[model samples]
Target: MVGGVKEEYQAAQELLTCMGANVVYCGPVGSGQAAKICNNMLLAIGMIGTAETMNLGLRLGLDPKLLAQILNMSSGRCWSSEVYNPVPGVMEGVPSANNYQGGFGTTLMAKDLGLAQSTATDTKTPVPLGALAHQIYRVMCARGYANKDFSSVFQFLREEEGQ
Candidate 1:
């Protein structure tokens, strides 16, 4: 459910419906933002986990393409691993294939993760991974990859490991 000012909510619902989005009214003013933060937090975690797994596979003598196929067909499968692989050449027409450009930027992802962390802290939620993901993105930003796609975390990790 999308929560907002009544008129604005109705207008938003209409626009979303027109755009083929399945719109539902969530609750109150901040609920939509809350949902968005939660989604972004999970997405961040998935992307980071996928990157780490791919890197580990590479270090263990697994071919990137074969490893990706294995992961996609197994329990390790995720949107990041199957659809938007972080490793270059494993997929085509994604941010990673384009030098990590023109996709969700690391700075924006960091901001979303920060929002999730703030909300989690306020609610006393034990979001260990979310907090860690926030720190990782913060470090990425500090190391000059803020403008790159968030999946570029793979690159950051690879470089740090001298891979």
Candidate 2:
């Protein structure tokens, strides 16, 4: 949670915890937002990378399930590649397997990426991949995938390739 004074921060955290939120006490008023921005930035990049990898694998005639398994077992493994594989049929019970519903929306991802870009600019930090990811999500939003789960990036990329 964001801060007011120490007591306020602790009180808010306690309240959030009582509400079943896994409240992490970020230092200052903006630090919680900063932390969330960073997290979503990384998540956007990972989701995009996972989609690209899966698309490439499919184009090369690799089985989607096998490719996802290989990626999960190899150095390429990440949450996106393993727990939330973007390719349909690669994993069940995730957004992709269910038509990209009921997960983090692309519009929200874009908004978070925009926040990351703004924060990076404010800090004079270089975030090349993060910037690219922001643009990707922005485009996805413009293309009408705003409300879809972010993992629908796989479908977006596939449609772009005329698959």
Candidate 3:
């Protein structure tokens, strides 16, 4: 997937053959397409998880922005935090808090997650989390916010009423 289309598909087919697996012709185009779907799905889930975790920190009164600062300065922060910035206002220039716009699209993510689920079922692998993630994204896409970024997952946070 990291390589160009031709290489990725060839690699997939080669791996399958090496493992004595059989399937229809999966060329570079196919591999690239599959990866596009899979990566976006996972990306959406990561965005959602990161947003929720940061919200949890806020509920602890850690000051999301401050906590985010600490994470960026510390090892606790990851790509979603350090690079993606899911808390919206925490990073001063991210999409999280601002209605989760200007980020990855929910529909794209749902499409990929759907592929992932299909793969899991075909392989008979345990991917309940992936399945659930796909379901959430499917619902998210069905909602009117289909135009927002994946970080729009923070919408879930705004909905939680904490008296």
Highest-scoring model, lDDT: 1
- Expressed as tens digits, the lDDT of each residue in 1-163 for candidate 2 is 4544667877667667886667777786778788888888999999999999999999999999999889889999999998988888888899988889989999999998998999899999999999999998999999999999999999999999999
Q: List the residue pairs that clash in candidate 2.
A: none
C-alpha local distance difference test of each model = 0.93, 0.90, 0.69
Residue 113 displacement in candidate 2 (angstroms):
0.8
Cα lDDT, model 1, residue 4: 81
Better of 1 and 3 by TM-score: 1
lDDT assessment of candidate 3: 0.69
How many backbone collisions does model 1 have?
Answer: 5
| Weakest lDDT window of 10 consecutive positions for candidate 3 | 21-30
TM-score of each: 0.92, 0.92, 0.71
Clashes found in each candidate (C-alpha, N, C closer than 3 A) = 5, 0, 2
Question: Residue by residue across 1-163, what tens digits does model 3's lDDT show?
Answer: 4234555555677675765554444344456466665666567666767777787887788887778788778766667778777666766556765667776777777777888888778879887777878887777777665787766767755554441
Q: Distance from true position, residue 87, model 1, in Å?
A: 0.6
